[model samples]
Target: MKANKAAVLTVAEKCKNILASNWQCHLSTIKADAKGSKGEIYTSKVKYIVKRGKPYVWVPESDAHNVNAIIDERGSLAITTPFPGPLAHLLKSVQKLPSRIALTGDVVLLKEKKAQLATEKLEALILSEQKAVNELSYTVRGVLSSTNPVFTSRSENLQGLTDGGENYNIYKFDLRSCTYLSGTGGTHEIDLGELQTSKADSLAPYSAMLIDGINQSESRRRALVLFCFTYLNARVKDAYILSLDRKGTDVLGKVPNPTSNEQFQWKEFRFTFKEEAPDVEALCCQLVEMEEEAIKKVSSYSGLG
Candidate 1:
């Protein structure tokens, strides 16, 4: 093996595969299928990486981020796995390499199947978790789809620190009408379900974080359950709310918790729900209103209007 046959073969096959099937590597050359009506195309610099003893090559950059997703989304393909070379050695051994390796149709098909399977698995996990969280909180809160929630300007493609587009707008509803009892209160306050309660039932497997406020003997006392996504992003996951009884409860975990007095002190978390996007001043004003709403909900069950 002049140059480590195993590694070289692996890399060669990968480069060949990239040259064969992937859309990113479909180069425009003097060869056939290289010309459109005008006959010119942009060049792409696609590369491969070798880690440990294995070599892997797929799409690069943004395309790579969603490469598998693209393949799996197509229903006709009915993919069950991802492309083979990118897989670990165990899976690599199981693959039945294509009869015509140059064309790379078999590898492409495998990639498609892998993507499809991964997509299905992710979807199933999310749905199952959602159902569990939803059912658990049905009696205490409401979770609404964040697709186009309220008046927040949504841009799915934009990546920013303040952007919430990638995340669905989660809203919590506590029909009790008391602001504090409705989680953060205010229209902007979405339900995280019942994240706090006696830990006796065992919510450890739920994927989201739990809140355990101190209490004499209520088992779980108070809690502010959050969705899985929120649980993972907390720099300081802390939440605080005051019940209508004026019992002050604060949750200190990942994100900042809402604050309120125990009795007659709950204002709502205000949100700007408008037909058009709010200006900076308007957004601030809306948040003010949201806080007021939260206050009202927490302070008086009858003052929701």
Candidate 2:
């Protein structure tokens, strides 16, 4: 595997290992634009349990709304916890290293249950694998500089060292260092330096047009799905455009029921435009027409009209 690919996979496996041992994690759902600007972050506490060696997350019913919004909006999830002793020692050994890193993951919202029922059942069957549950696979990236001070301050407070009980530290991660990836298997290392200077329109003409069109639309997510269905001819779930360049647009989402097991896995779809869209309005019109055609095709196939 390539270096980037290896890095991503390592992060995913290590995260699973950590969760399996600790069983408790902090989950944060974030909504941000392709440009990495202007977004909201919501956090919830959740339990991670290992079943049949696979990790499954259990969220309280009260937190379901936040989690579902993440899936519907094609937002990102940041799963974090204070570094365990072993992990913290490893990180501390590296000089000039980031205080924190954020990993990108795919979140599948499992069936919901009442808080009391979930708690009781989980307590009883803690060692067994449940039939259906929420889960994610994540790729990580370092969040430099800005994170260190806050983590340091939180650590001092947590250990009661500011008042000098002992010279102890327990770092805490904040949501600001959120790392959002495509969620599809492919991994791309985001150069934070470049993000500071690059404009959204720096992408290819068609790529730029599509992103801008959807973003400007009254219903951005709806427009994105219609465009994919019409142009790529694929039914996608939890879809989001990751990046666009002169060559094509990199999309991330799940194909509904692609496997025999009925489990959805994130996949990347790349689309190249035959001709660049002239402008945002033209792109929107094109998408609307595609949606209409899609509806007609469904109507014809189902013999409903």
Candidate 3:
């Protein structure tokens, strides 16, 4: 139940960042009165959106979890960070495991004005984020755009917000407690107040873009090696950017054995920014400055400065 008060993002902020980046969760709930299944707990994968410190999901009225919500309002959601495909090579390392979070709370169906407003907000947010349908190919996008019952019926049900029509209903999962498991095997209990007030990392949504771009560019990729050599004094090869946040970035590299130079070992290095960046533009500027410093140090050491 200890908290990592010194970490860049408190346990709560990391939780919010992971939740906002991912749009789906494993939802679990108790079963309503139905024959022998009456007190059983059921788990299902569902799409959700975090709005104003709350997670909301749209489900069919007849869905088992929805029915369960009517009788027992207790529920929980589990979310895990997805490891990017580019980093698949590091999968064997235990230190590179994905971070996970579990939240327990009350599951209540929305009503009246709240339902109406949540519907509008949910649709707008989902469409804006596009995480739900971001993988749609051109053909699939075209099919969904056409006049079809599959598309039309879903739109109709979505419009019937307050009453939920005959098909769908909206439910809000109110957060009561949270547990966060870090990538390094540490666990912490998040404070509800911190969870309520913390904002998701500003660069989270675009972090993948940044990492991909750096890995693709030769000069940028070499900059990582140069920085490690200059600051950490470690000669490395096959280095790549691992993760990025507002405060700093993590890089993983293969270090060669000094004696044999035949065996290679993997090591992780962190570079903290001179100051916290408010946006990507500032972040890039800080990195460029660091690269310049690294180059100067390397040149001076080689007596070429």
Q: Pick by TM-score: which candidate is best?
A: 3
Worst lDDT 10-window in candidate 2? 136-145
- Model 1: per-residue Cα lDDT over 168-229, one tens digit each: 11111112111111122222221223212111111212101121111111222212222111
lDDT rank, highest first?
A: 3, 2, 1
Question: Model 2 — TM-score against the truth?
Answer: 0.28
Clashes of each: 47, 0, 0
Model 3 alpha-carbon drift over 4 Å, by segment: 1-7, 31-33, 36-41, 60-63, 92-95, 123-168, 215-219, 256-265, 299-305
Q: In model 1, how large is the Cα lDDT of residue 4?
A: 28
The worst-scoring run of ten residues by lDDT in candidate 3 lies at 146-155
Residue 170 in model 2: shift from native, Å? Answer: 37
- lDDT (Cα, tens digit) per residue for candidate 3, span 19-119: 86665679899987754337678998776767787898766666788778877899999887644434545645524666789999998999877877877
TM-score of 3: 0.72
By TM-score: ranked, best first? 3, 2, 1
Which candidate, 2 or 3, has the higher lDDT? 3
Most accurate candidate by lDDT: 3
lDDT of each: 0.23, 0.38, 0.70
lDDT of 2 by residue, 111-192 (tens): 3353334334445453222111111111000111112322322212222212333321111121122242323333434444
Candidate number with the higher TM-score (1 or 2): 2
